[model samples]
Target: MTDVTSAPRELRKGANVAIRDLGGELGGLTVFLDSRGHDGETIDADVSVLLLDASGKVRSSADFVFYNQPIALNGAVHLRDKLVPEPDSDEAAAGWSSDVVTLELDDVPQEIERIVVAASLDASTARTFGDAAGVRLRLQRSSDAADLLVFDIDDATTESALVFGEFYRRDEDWKIRAVGRGYQAGLAALVTEHGVDVSEEADEPEGPEAPAVDETPDEAPAPPGDAEQAPAPPMPAEVDDDTGTSSPATPAKRSVSVRRPTRAPRLPVDWNASIPADDGNDWQAARLFPVAGIGSGEEQERRATSALLAVMSMVREFGAALTGRCGAPRGTITTYIEVPFGQDEEAYRPDGVIQVRRGTREWTALVEVKTSTGRLNVEQIEKYVEIARARGYDAVITISNELAGGDADHPVAVDRRKLRKVSLHHLSWDQIRAEAVLAARHRGVSDATQAKVLEEFIRYMSHARSGMGGLGDMGPSWVKLRDAVKSKTARASDKATGEISARFDELIQHLGHHMTGLLGVEVQSLAPREAPDHASRRQQLADSGLMFGRLKVPGAVDVLVVGADLRADKASAAITIGAPRGDTRPLTRVNWLLRQLPDEAKDSIRIEAHMAGPRAVSTAALLGKARQDPSCLVPEEQREIKAFTISLEVPLGNKRAAGTGTLIGSVKGATTTFYADVVQHLRPWVAKVGSPSRAE
Candidate 1:
């Protein structure tokens, strides 16, 4: 392995470098397109990959992987979900949004000569790469998540599509080149150039149409001999359809049928069966992995490790979902508990070992487990990395209760030098449980027994005795910081204040992760647009006596804003949506929103109408009051309505624990209640077809 401590080589436009030159071998590599814009501008772009043959063209449509086709080549090339950094983390502070594409180089087919990584603006958004700042690509060795190369594209102008780089075959070796080329014609044209059949009619209904048939032949069919002697029906006369002029006939081209891969139907799980029935009996069903007698942290760790590993080995879908996130190729997975290893006369037994075998290749990782409130030890992790490196393992994975803030960074910082050959990764118990729920309940497990086993594992992990709790405490500084903030004496630079802020961010992240599992959709934590960095957010909290975070739930009308107001002793969740454009009367617009809410919402929700004009003030009214008059929320001056904000507030909890009357509980409860009662029911206003716009 090359010296990983060396600084990543920065490539200029059109520069080429070999993969071996940077990482010493061609293995699992990840391409990250980290994009940001100045002045809080959002760069809406999509990253895609094209696998090409020696002709520099895709072999088939299946070779293209993008938002629509996220995985291709049997998991050799996969476009991962967009990852947003925690609002207060360094990545978020720098305004970077990451889109990742993983490449299992060894798994790439022998016929594939090149892998191209490209990015393009979303067709719905009329924006170009020039609008973005610090648009760059980082190539990281997936095994260690270490950056080997970085390329910055500084000259993108009027271009909607860009080819950041490509990995191509070089004799018996693979090499990468920085190809910072741009296309103003956007994704379709760029992909077409690479031999993807760009079908504008792809969105149209599928299935073959019946051919027009003539029941009566125009004439008696010719005899077989006559037919054989007949010249092919005279070629249709060639003419310029646009100019009505004769033109030369051209040879017909062979049409290539590129069929999009069909996605398998997701089977539904019997969630009701998974839930235990309370019949007031002392008898309970026997579980595959029981969590009954866990008394110490060690016991909890052992049971959790054994149960999770065993399940991962049995359930194919669940295991792939988890291992794929750690950069392992799709393969047959085998997991073992308490794997023993020795290095330099020192013996070490990692909690588990995960080995994934694909064809002749095998990828292995050492796992360290921590249950309850056990924190990862820095020296312990460094030692494991050393052992993994000596043993030629690919990665060292740590599973614990501690939540990683941004970029899946480890809670404990280990020496960077030890991670050159072996990568280090962290997984929170909350994340593991969430993934399990998604796989078994949402994504579906094909085998009935495997699904049952996964469900059992989930039940065992959910048990309080298992000690795999999710985001339970706000840390020891919660009380003092809460008091100081309430009293208006918390300094921005105070150690306690920083701790509280960091923990609060973690709470918000965990909330999003939890919602993802429940809703079967990815929910993300976002920084308030006004405060882009942690320092500014801390200052904002110190000045306003409030901490604010936002959640971006897919398909929601708007990002949900959550606020914890220390001064007011309230926790609130709110969302703002634009008013219907065609409605002429304020009453109609007000009723438009009112009609979407359930009748019970009138009791606890508040509505605010934001009026147009620079100096216009928004009108506020409780939903119950607004239900009666509607005019209560309308401005007396009759300023045109611009938008409306619906919000719910609950008394903030003061304690630091997980259950009722605790700060974590209150925040989570408030967000969940707001979503269930309000956000879920509200739809974004869309202009109705054929509806006339009324003049103000």
Candidate 2:
């Protein structure tokens, strides 16, 4: 049974409480600032953190972590990527945007006595906190994602920045205090109060001001009118003894500057775009990591492991992207292959090992990898856990073809007792490929050679001979369960039914990762929070003869809901978005949505209008017919149209492999096609300025 915690304790302004009182001995906490702009306005509120000493001031400028300086105190505190509301969620409907600040409390330096969390508006904008609504903070335990407390800032006027709260050390424990303090001068004044040196550059009307400061603020300020600031002392570059490759040069410690980080210039060529199609006579380029000689599963695993580790070691951004997810500190990463270890009387050789060094502290994780259809061996993983624990390693990571759930659940089961000392994580080959693509294609690497190497790795992993094809098989029980459900003979407790349900969940999860890589945005699979467990999902499948999933694309007008219906032998993808506000005429609202979609979308898509009332009359029509007669979707009784749902249905495939006639391919194809044709083009209708707030 899920733990039913009471409502989060709301804290009034100036209220303080012990962190232990809310949740005892937390590994870490996450502060979420959910801010909403006034109707039709855009608010770009940025959240930041400050690590202060006993004197209530930062020891150095590095102690300030914000958008420009994201990491502080050796990764104990960092600013996460701006969070977009889940599509179709209440937050999305209400136009809420969230900024997250993560605190690895256990990793915070002992000298840090207080951690302050604050938010600031873009200085270039005239809007203030008064122009924002629903500005609140929710403190959550990062371990289980449970809300520990909530504070709503209801009192605000003309303030450009606000200090929402702070965590202070009390003896050996920590305590949180809600501080609803505001600053009228914006981010410059806000950070200046926290010991950051802000430059006095005249503000530009069109562009943001450059509030430059020396990296180490403790140094004497450079003379005014100096052309350039001093750079940090560079460390001697170290070459890896194993691969004979030069590692990124470490830099001397530096303080933070109150300035936006310079954005990288766009590359001359768009590496992400596809090259022009060529005739059969075109020359083929040689790859950095060739797959031509791969023969057996062992060779495949070895080559894949070596290739991944080598690329990670060479590419700084790619390495940080992967290791950061594993809770490693932001620093130098070194990887080794076939590391030998001993636990009790047995000797073990894991596929690879990863080590991260930040300052004098280091974290290590052992990696075990498998390719193709090979499943993880529980005993082998358990032995790795033992080795990691005995050797004081931080984690043991497993890579295989299997898919884990959206919640990072491991595919292989191991003894829970053995994992007390060493954490274990699993990464699917699909996920690894997605991350590689996201880094190389979407998020560019700084060094051109490193970028080329990452691109080559992506190509190598994508090749057919690499054996990294993801989600190709839906398991042997797929056909049996499909027939059973269609014939009305499937039971909730049947083994085949459960397996099919699990695979369907995996498919949805894979779709999220795949779309995220392709679109360069985070796409999350919305697992039913009420029925998140395996048993509940299996029961849901048996009862409805339908396996359903929803993908939440950030900033999308509506959630993309996909379903596979065994009874109907069809798969469908749909999106439901509210109709245009301030427009009462159903035809006008229908035309508003129609204008966003292309002419081709009318063929495969269906449009439905949801009307207001107790009964809530709903009328639907094919897009083609609706285009000719928009009134067909509007209720004759003249009820108010509340929303519209656009959907596309395709024949469900019956086979197991992800090919032309397979279930996996059909569902994936339907979703991507629908998104490209419909979802990507549709923007939520915002009311015009000076328009009536209510429907006519």
Candidate 3:
């Protein structure tokens, strides 16, 4: 204890730091750096923790002292490095991430297990995060098909990755080679600059000696060349996922109904027919160009232009909107698009071209968007009037400025009115979900309260006005709703004190096992009761003959947990375990009326178990007489008064956090307002009582 090992230090450089590895074997080093003090506001320059060896020099140093302070990342917002793994069991309807979805191309999907797609629009730009528009689809399997793992697309942008339905741009006219005969013979020796060879079936072996996925210690090559990274077999394969939608031969209805994946399988043939389909009038302007309600396609305007390219990619202002019913695409002309039958390409990305410019004149506004509702035969509007008459353009439709002009008074003004793209809308779906909740709270991404004003719904289209800004109208997106409101305002500003000490120790062992089976003994101690000491209860009731009488019953038990010192503790008395079942309709016949008796009794005596367990009385109170009742609980036992839960353990250094969030609620009639984002684990107070009140 007298030798602290010869110490001394000195060193300096451009240095820059911030650390706190406490608990790392006795928590030493606590330095802090990045100068600029005295009100200039930036401090921390302690540095010392050296100790390098293998030829790097320095072997003994110690000065660092973490707990270091000084913070400010400007307006602060870096929600990255979330270390994935937060999908908590299908998450409330596809939350937490299924690559933020939206695909409904034409309805008919449900057999999922592996079906993530986005060969276009930015390799599925995280499907525009947040309310993943009717979510469901999820897929994750690959040794290295260019490992995005499942979306990381360079900090993920381009409007959050085109809502991830599909994207893969590189076809300089098509020449990546290798078209058919599928694959397997070692993926035909592997290759792809565009030769995009895809055999997909290997790595199958799932049982016996299931060990050879790859160990090598001898052979290795695959790195960024992920032609679908290989791991196991390559033969015995079986993939069945399903989802569907397609009808324009004569039956149009649908307004809002989702859930698809009824049949997407069959790949090996041109993999996915070279991704095309947009002709049913360019999927009615790509999924209804959202601003209110109605459709066209391009995935209903890919969630407000990936939510306005995550805020200000330039400028946007759609009013009244209302889409679907069909046709309304205007101005810039030049059509000729056609993706029939197999449409739902992740829910209809129509792309028939709709450039709407005039935000200040490059003037070019164009058109072609389409729709019919659902089943539209007659060759789906005759292949959209022969792809807008072989790419000529000039079919002005686009209705809803609130349906253009009915009652003959120009609805919400779109200039004179009378437009025609026709398939169904004149303005409905509750006025486009009421202007998409006032445009998702005027774009700050909702939170105006009154319970989020129906999340400001917006989508009812009719376009064909282009000056270059109709790349399928990418308008409002909110970076996963501002990262789900800054992860719910940093989980409501932290501190639940380990969820209130594990919900007060699981509600005191769930109401202390029904109060130790109604006092038949065996409770040892529950502690924490305080707030009562009238001279230590009159000096333990002046040496108990066992009668300090303080009877106040209307559902007794209020802080009288005499568990251990019952006069020298006869193993903790209060052992009258039996017969006590009352209250069938008391409390002034349910309105819970308690007007008298509680003026602070001196020796305590406020009786009323219907004035002694009702004995056979028959009703008569508040307005005169006194007793009348006989139902002391026994109608098939009676129970309903227990709820409170919380359980925390979160250390989150990654290892895929299996615990940590603890908090509980659902308790009634006393006090409750939890919801700091609904984390859970507390348990105490679990009443399912009903009748058994006197049990041991």
Q: What is the TM-score of each candidate against the true structure?
A: 0.67, 0.70, 0.18
Instruction: Rate residue 644 of model 1 by lDDT.
Output: 96
Worst 10 residues of 3 by lDDT: 668-677
Off by over 4 Å in 2: 1-98, 101-278, 281-284, 406-408, 529-537, 693-696
Encode model 3's per-residue lDDT on 329-403: one tens digit a residue.
111212222223233232222323333222121211122232222111333333433344334432322222111
Global local distance difference test of model 3 = 0.21
Best model number under TM-score: 2
Give a tens-digit lDDT track for model 1, residues 1-696.
Answer: 123666888987666777888853376787888788886555767898988775566766778888666777656687877767756676676678888888878778788878889998754345789888879998887755678888899988777788888887776788877777777767766776666766544321422211111112122122222111212223445778899865333222222222222121111233214445688989967778877777878988898899889888899878887897787866789999887888789888999999998767799999999988888998889989988888798999999888765323677888888888888888888888888998887667778998999999888888888878777798988888888887788888998877777777788888887777777666778743333477776776777778878898765778889888888888899999888665477777787778778776646688999987797679998888888889888778666788999999999888889878887888888887788778776665533224435321
Residue 312 error, candidate 3, Å: 16
- Cα error, residue 202 of model 1, in Å, equals 17
- Candidate ordering by TM-score (highest first): 2, 1, 3
